[model samples]
Target: MQQRKQQLLRRHRQRKRVALLLGLPLLFSSALWFWWLPLPLLLAAWVLHEAYFADHLFYAPGDDYDYRFAGAGVSVSITADGRLGLAQLEGIAEADTLLLEVTIKADWRGCWVDPRVLIDVAQPHDQQTFERGCAGRRVVNLSGLGPALAAGQVRLRGRYCRLAGQATLHVLRNPDYACQRMLILAPHADDAELAAFAQYQRGAEVTIATLTVGELEAEPYQQLGLSAIEAARLKARLRSWDSRHAASWGGVPAERCFQLGYFCMQLPAMRAEPLLGHPSKVAQTGDIRPLRKGNALPLPGDVDGQPSWFNLLGDLRGLIEHYQPQVIVTPHPQLDPHADHQATTAALYEALAVSHHQPQTLLYYANHLHDNDRWPMGEQGEGVALPPALEPLTVAGVWSPSLSGAAQIDKSMALGLMHDLQTPLPGKKKLRRVLQHYLAGRRWPRWGVDEFYRKAIRRHELFFVQPWPIKDQAQRPE
Candidate 1:
């Protein structure tokens, strides 16, 4: 009887173990179905929300359209009536005659409409040849022009028939007029206020300059004389800059600076100045020097008694000494395409590397392209918009959120007006709307008022105290 009881107990224990093992998976599977399934859905929704509302979000480019040219000589004029006018070729037209191509962009996605291109010639009765239903582009074959017709100046005008609203008329002359128009429409400097600001008692001096690297975005490394390896290195360096400054400046600033390296041209307008107020002195550099009528120093080749990094360094060092500024503000390396910005950054880094008497240096980044859709993201190519990382710099700074929405709007309007020559083609109202939307949503996490230098370390803008070092000791840790 005892043997039989012991055998039964062993069988009961085995049954209990089997039951426990079977229950474990059922419990686990239940938990996963109830919790994990919902988690993924929730995460997806959050990602979508963030993508739509993120301040740095950029839209993808739409489908491409076939643009054909009307084989005709065209002249475009802005009449006193504030209306656009056009005229066609009537002369012994020859091939490759000067064809004025005016592009009018649409404000939004829509069908094509026949908008009149007005033309005002001194005399209205001139024999003007009209080419109807030609391609969207204007082409003049002046091969058959008689001398009499060749001598006669004909005005040509046509509105953009079918294009998106965000499109701007990119008028292409024999030589590109985009840069010239951008300059012509730039803002005028405030001499009196600037002079007064320069005179204001301060411990430091300030200089403002704009640098450009033509068509860097479309052809980055090759155009800029950088090898693929060098370009990769440069990109890594830029990422380091972004990472180091991201805590204070956000990742967008560095990206903006990088974009500027490619498509940058100095605009006549100084939108940043009002925010910065008047510097102790405004020393312009690069192409900016040509715009200023004052006697300007040549680009620097050396600093103090040392060989500088780039030609502009010597001048910057001299300027720093002459100004005796307690703080020096300049663009980060990402801002320029030609080795100019990188050279400047290197020079500043070198200057600070050896000297104990120098003032605190702060780097500020400006946007390269103003339009929202073109934010240094996927618009141009496959590379990521934000840098992969940031570097530890001697001193870093971030943009202040002090400017109000209205103020930003006013500034944008002023800048747009200043760059009237580069004005978007008709129906580009969407660009203005996009800019306004950006301004409205723009905000930087305030890090209190005491921190002087702010760096964008990653996703956030961080502020740092820029204390000067003692004369004999290593610079204090920021």
Candidate 2:
């Protein structure tokens, strides 16, 4: 409340400053000739001064926060700290990475100063800074945070701040991203998990990859009126968020995961098809990918100027050749809804066919295809049912390992770690509604969130396999 009062004072001063700037020029003219001009000028100043009262920022905070930094102009939280510090977090000390969850309110109509997370690392006396784009928020993990935690180098010291925004912090608990020699691919950041995380365990090598950078070149952010710099920063931040997702969820070493860096929302052009309506606007612009301070660009051979379809195919082929994964899991090309998802499946299929190591198995998953279904997710035919197009694929066997209750918690943590991507934008109203019901299931102990996750933890994760053709489902982990 005190801080808000201060911000109000500052805003008042700022408005007054602007009012003075506008009025002084006219008043000076009036002093010289148009004395009556001051009357209208003062009225304009008053109108502007009173306008600030209507600014609207609102958000929900968790139990961890004791204060409400509620305001208009885009910030609402139940758990916000005045001094900016970590919330009540425990059991995450064992995690290689941790996610700090928060909620935010953005103006949705103007440029917002991207929120920043600063972490003070131990012994090395180093500082890592991350920009958290203005959405109902999520924490930015510090560079080397996972290794630092695993190595017992230091306890993290953190703070959050954003210009033209307000944030409330929450917690995404411990995630054990364990795997050995497992390679998973998703067109988007979270898809890898939703698509393939049904059967993961620790103590194995794991490599996770995303086909696109997951920034629709900030089309949504721009629609929300962010500046170019702000948009780019958000893209880079999202990349970082996915990087953390790999480390924390895949339980693989950070270097093992990779992003293919395709321009988002524009894959149709690569498939010899028209661009999606959303990304079509940026199809011609070569600068859609985020170019951040530490982020890298695609190699010349992998992605051409506009990142064509052939380029995506080449990259997927190269990745398969390099990883030589025995079991390749990806989306069912014929069933997914998003253009990029379909493209990824197609590219992966082509890459595998063309690659030297044909791998032991090809498991095709279909989750996004059923989003609009009335039954919701987490079933073989109802929530997570396969499209008839993929009926022949998983006919051999589905390798869904029974997730122990404890394992379920770990999966939840992994899913929670992905809160950044899960945090919805105005455009994701439908998704939010789904999640709301999903979360409600957790509360009701009915066919809900628990049931949804139970699908992944089921006795088998459904997949289509052919004996020699698909190589007889890759040896399932015991």
Candidate 3:
């Protein structure tokens, strides 16, 4: 795979050089006579870019914490012909749920066409994709194969893709998602919906606490002819309102959804000086003021609403003490590259330490992964596998709660309620955007490629179950 990638890179560079050599003179001449000629050339250039760089079809295995913590229950080896595999369940008791991890090497053809591997283990058939051309280790949930799997051995017959050698399979127990009370910590308003709308929609007592109203990116409201500050304020208020409505779609009421008013992109600065308040650059407001009355935890008399790390942690501690949630869902600091997300989890840990509240489970999610936005590698209503193995994955086990088609539609509708998720009017650049999507073999504004609708509204939502009350932590992982 590495050699094939290198070869493709060399060919891509060669193609670029050849195109430039022939196209520069044409562009110069076209500028003088045919103004429209540059447009076709531009479209051609975009085509070349999409053909070569659009899909990332490479997978490097991250730290397999699941296997490291829970040793394989059964290791199945494929037959010499790569058509059949077998797993012997000896001395194994009855289990409710299990996770099957498959290690595969993607072929060069994966670059042009997305690779889909179908594995049929007796009763239920499952399909797994090497998302974004990744072919390291992909896990599938084995739900109904309970007592039959523990009876004895099982034969695994599946259609194989391009395989170099025998595939290795490890069957391990999946994490439990049972919780009495669940609290989701979202960096922004839509984040809770993106990561765990399905999780809370049909579960025990649930509360969503949004860290910020996500008012920083006011560019979308520029069409409304509002000034930057006014637009930011409006964006903040509307998204805060949208959060309650969106959470309602997930069965969480307005009273249960709390918006901890903090400025976007200011968490890192607040983390540095916990006592100092950080002002919003977009809204031009410095105070930590909730948009709606009684929509947030009440601050102490001495501690007014000021956007500071101390206040943020205080709110988190207050929630933890008040709700006493068994499951706390937040972003993984290491995997998520966003500064606000990292800071949100960091504050949660500090609050946990100060409050000394040990939740039974900590569900960590990563909405912002390494470069590629189009991950899980398929259309909507498809199984959402693990994200690209860019960062060292740290989790006790993987939990992928399957959502019905109706649930997926509800998630899509919930995501659509967010003003930020709506596609902005391309205006003058509309033609360029259309041509780019057309040449890339993609449809525009049908839940934009990077939106939560495409990324989150899937057959299942994925979460990494990190150990609760991390022991001996000087600081969160870097």
lDDT of each: 0.28, 0.45, 0.67
In the range 1-478, model 1's lDDT, one tens digit per residue, is 1233345456656765786577567656756778565456545544433333222212112312223322222444534342333234342233212222333332221112212233334343111111112133221211112232345443333333321212212221221111111100001111101111111111122233222222122224445797654553343334223222221111112111211111122211122221121110112112222221221343443122112123233344554554445544333333222223333334455555554347643423322211122222211111111211112223222221112234333322222221111222333334433443353221221321110101111111111212333342322211
Relative to the true structure, candidate 1 reaches a TM of: 0.28
The residue ranges of model 2 lying beyond 4 angstroms of the native Cα positions read: 1-180, 198-200, 217-225, 228-233, 243-245, 273-306, 370-394, 424-460, 466-478
Model 2 lDDT per residue over 1-478, tens place: 2233346457656875785787687788776777677788776555433332212222121112122111211122222222223233343343332333343333322122222233334443322222222333333322224444334444433334332223432222212223424567777766666555545445366667676655545655665688765665566567546653455554555566666656666665667642322232333344323321222334333333345666566666776677777666776544455666667766776666677766666666665442222112222211122222212222343332223456555555565555334444353434443443443221112223433343443322344432224443332210
Please give the RMSD of candidate 3 to the true structure.
Answer: 6.0
lDDT for model 1, please: 0.28
lDDT at position 405, candidate 1? 34
| lDDT (C-alpha) at residue 425 in model 2 | 38
Alpha-carbon TM-score of each model against the true structure: 0.28, 0.48, 0.80
Please report the TM-score between candidate 3 and the true structure. 0.80
Which residue pairs show collisions in model 3?
Answer: 56-132, 57-133
Task: Mark the regions of model 1 whose C-alpha exceeds 4 Å error after superposition.
Answer: 1-205, 211-309, 332-343, 353-357, 361-363, 366-401, 417-478
Looking at model 2, residue 210 earns an lDDT score of 75
* Total clashing pairs for each candidate: 75, 29, 2
